[model samples]
Target: MATAEKDGKIYCRFSRPKSLASMKVEEEDDPSGPTEITIDLSSGKVIFIAVGKTYNGGNDLAEHVEAPVLSSGKVDFSQFKVARGTTMTLLTQLHGVAMVLAWMLFVSFATVEGRYFREGFGSKMVCGLKLWFQMHRVVTMIAGILTAAGFILIFVKVKGLSKNAQAHTYIGIIVMAATCGQIFLGLIRPDATAGWRPKFNWAHRLLGKATHILAAADLILAFRLPMVSPEMRHFGTTVVAVWISVQVVWEVTFEVNKYLQSKSPKVDSIPGKEETKIEEKVIWKDPNGRLQLILCILFVLTIVSCSVATLCAILIF
Candidate 1:
């Protein structure tokens, strides 16, 4: 065993011998023996020196040794400066890309698909399911898969949860858990004609909306993290702002169109002829159906544009 004393503070090392046979312990610290060298003074402030092979296969699990402190009572970390202009790790890039695609692209696409494309694709069927249902389900599933993968990659890169418990970390975990829950809820959704279908639909919509909001917030937070470049943060924040504006416009347009449809006559006729009222619920085939389809296409196009821009910013900046 070797011990270091600096500025009247003592630091010690404890270790098991490499040999299987036991040896007699010495009363005094050995200066010539191996020791555990302390590399970081920022956290846990302890310093050590290697003595021999550790008890647990080479792992060092020794208790903290009293650290040497300056007269000001501060442990100086001036020697451990972070490297400037260091490139981000590959895992971090992959994690960011995956999350951007999941929330900025797939989630938004899925929401628009379910909200406005149902009537446009109401007549089309994919297998036994409606086209809108298939598209929404598939897109949402992809988002969930991407979210899970991104979460795992970041967790592995970080080697576990953050010790400081950052807000970004907490929000990310919440978004991931909620995304999984949303997928499960979708799978167990009641049939359209079931008695509880209304409740299910409302629950699903609300959960989806909440998850989407949180996911967006998390992405913004990620852009603002200390590791991210300032250029990326500015570009990402701008892209998100424009994307949100587009969403608001699309939603307002849809609501206005729906309101106008409700107030207008059910059927169109010659200008001089009496308009007829239909009793059947509106799905498609209305006079404004083509307009709704056009609106959906425009909304989707705008969303895709914003997502692509944000992705490019993430990759380049």
Candidate 2:
């Protein structure tokens, strides 16, 4: 058999013994239309025929459906629904869950705790480390793990970089690289008294904030990719918008509060003299620490809700 094209239409030719041949004309422009076939016989006669539209593998070309798997004595995949796309799979769903939890929830909370909640926790120690530092370290560790795991899952599913999802894929690679670098830097952080400690702190904070921003951007790009369903894309976009808005509000409110706290006057007294009002720079202590706690709690709740909503959008479709 051989194929040819005439007038922008494809024709498949089949040759048989005894001087016989056949040609099938396919609907190139509109596969939903009827097909035509011609047969040439040894007696110098031709037969022309028409048939209804034939199967064109449209669904297969458009999307891929994962096969059900049986493992560990039973099949468990039936309980979960799989979305229809080349990039939508059980692994991709899990990847989305991991990323949302990592970047949007854990990392966001960790950044807030380290940045603004230090005064709230004071010098309180947990396991010989400052309370804020401990919480930040632990939460960031979880986020790092999730970020790495999600990267691995998607890489395994795709088997290589994706050409169609260039924006998401490249941004994800950069985010993953930054995350790994941040983790390494955190693990080898210098003591406060070290001359280079300030430099390390700046590098750490900047890398972390940049990674978080890139990860968020990658998520938004993922939603815009062709493989994602329209419903999932819309839902994910809304969730990201709300999460970003809350983060911005939380940061601005705390910064303003910190500024006001720094400028407030404090009462001072001598051993044998009257009390005096002194203007001092109180950078480390926040008189409105309670407000920080309240706002932090609300911000955390919003992150969790957004993460869960985004996960459901990826998994349920």
Candidate 3:
């Protein structure tokens, strides 16, 4: 890295390595010259000049040139060295892991305890209380804690919400708030004896469903951030695809089991009454099929959106 003064204006130049140069330019277009980054210290503006053409400082070079050189005509030579990554980057990865694990646990609880074991397997109680209820409570609490901690780490590293992080920050905040509301509603859930039981149940269910969708969206949006790596983003996409497949399979199985149970014959006997009653109780059901269809459509759209966004981010950086 070198700095120069011409016509009383200061400019900083960065020497491009062979590897980076080859990556940036085709063999035919290669100038066999170093790329120069010019910083206007007075105005705090920076630009890149290569192959006799100038380009504005985009996201890829912004981290290296913007702050240090723009602030004081001084480029930190240390930054040019091959990076081993940063602690903050590792923290962000950990945060993603925690959140993803939490989500997986949540999905397992909803599928196994809520639908499979409860409805298909005809399990009533596991530890005195309903199996689904116990698992849901435990898994959701862990998820909520992980979400909160991950959200806090963003602010801690960035010092404050940066412009690039605005969308992610807002969505994360909304998800956390919704999670709190979900926990509160779950705790205050009413029993069959209460007059407001139906209304309460509907509200709780709706809120929980919305929170899960929003949280998934938030996870996808994270891939757009600059600090995240492309390999990591691709891995995220794979994980999401697997999660979607699991959900689809679980939903189909649940629906099939429910239909079969409804069709099977049932008999209830009562003394002094020559009438038989048939009753079927299903723990999970989509009455109109509209909600399930809409949710599946949304999941597909989200996956496409995240994949496209990840590609765009990779191109930009």
Candidate 4:
């Protein structure tokens, strides 16, 4: 032992001789793991070294220190182990962080998926949409926090991640990029462009579709791709998809029935009956203009925010 004994405690420190293998991950599968080193705390000596098969497959890349050569340079073989092992602490920390983050993003996606549209268009649904939108923001904030944190954590402990995690990262990166693209489309203004640019609405809507597609892909990668092991990704995806379908059904039904009911204002049909000014007697009872304005504002805000957030995440991380 290289460590010295303190007043009431015993400390053990050890160091290894120097070598080239300790500088990088020697694993056959994952080549990005950390290099091994010998640390002698009491003696205050740290040296680079390499060994046999490690838990991460790192050791297989290098040979252990054999007995010293015939001359003055003798190698130390006494401390060599046939199998190498990984540090449990680092692996645990990395997995814990990534898992937490992935789960958070999943939760956010789930929250906003099934409830917004159907409940957003009704007289009573005004409050419902408000509350749902509030929760949506909450979930979005949580996901952003988790994703940023997880990205850092995974980058640090990358070697320990299974292939699935690696795949998940790639898909996540794409989703992030799509999200940014979606946001970018919103910054356009027709007047500012001197008519040289494409329509902002079209670009924005297209990117939104892209973002939605990428989100689905992200869920798949995060769950089934490589090393990702989230238990709820599939279930959440199914639920969201089903909910979206139902919302579509409801929208179609509402629109078809509404169109049929609105067949009147039939003043247009009686064109030959002398152009009478019926407009003066028409009394509008529904004060829907104000509500329409509010809904429009909400839509615009949601688009701007979701786009900005997705873009920011992709750019920063």
- Candidate with maximal lDDT: 2
Residue 186, candidate 1: C-alpha displacement in angstroms: 1.5
What is the lDDT for 258 in model 1?
A: 64
Q: Assess each prediction's global lDDT (C-alpha) against the native.
A: 0.71, 0.74, 0.55, 0.43
What lDDT, from 0 to 1, does candidate 3 have?
0.55
Q: Which ten residues in a row have the lowest lDDT in candidate 1?
A: 63-72
In order, what is each prediction's RMSD in angstroms? 13.8, 12.9, 12.8, 13.9
Better of 1 and 4 by TM-score: 1
Write the candidate numbers in order of decreasing lDDT: 2, 1, 3, 4
Q: What is the TM-score of each candidate against the true structure?
A: 0.65, 0.68, 0.56, 0.36
Better of 2 and 3 by lDDT: 2
Off-target runs (Cα >4 Å) in candidate 4 are: 1-150, 159-167, 185-198, 226-317
- Cα lDDT tens digits, model 3, 1-317, are 99999999777766653232212212223455335444333332222322222223332222221111112223344354322222124455456655665554454345334444443223567788776567666767787787778777767767777755557678878888987897788778788799999898788767776777776677666655544555556666565655556555756765665565454445777778776757655545555555544554554454445445433333322
lDDT of 2 by residue, 65-112 (tens): 222221212223224432223325568778888999999999888888
lDDT for 289 (candidate 3): 52
Instruction: Give one digit per residue, the lDDT tens place, for model 1 in 113-166.
Output: 787667676588889888889888889889999999999999998899976556
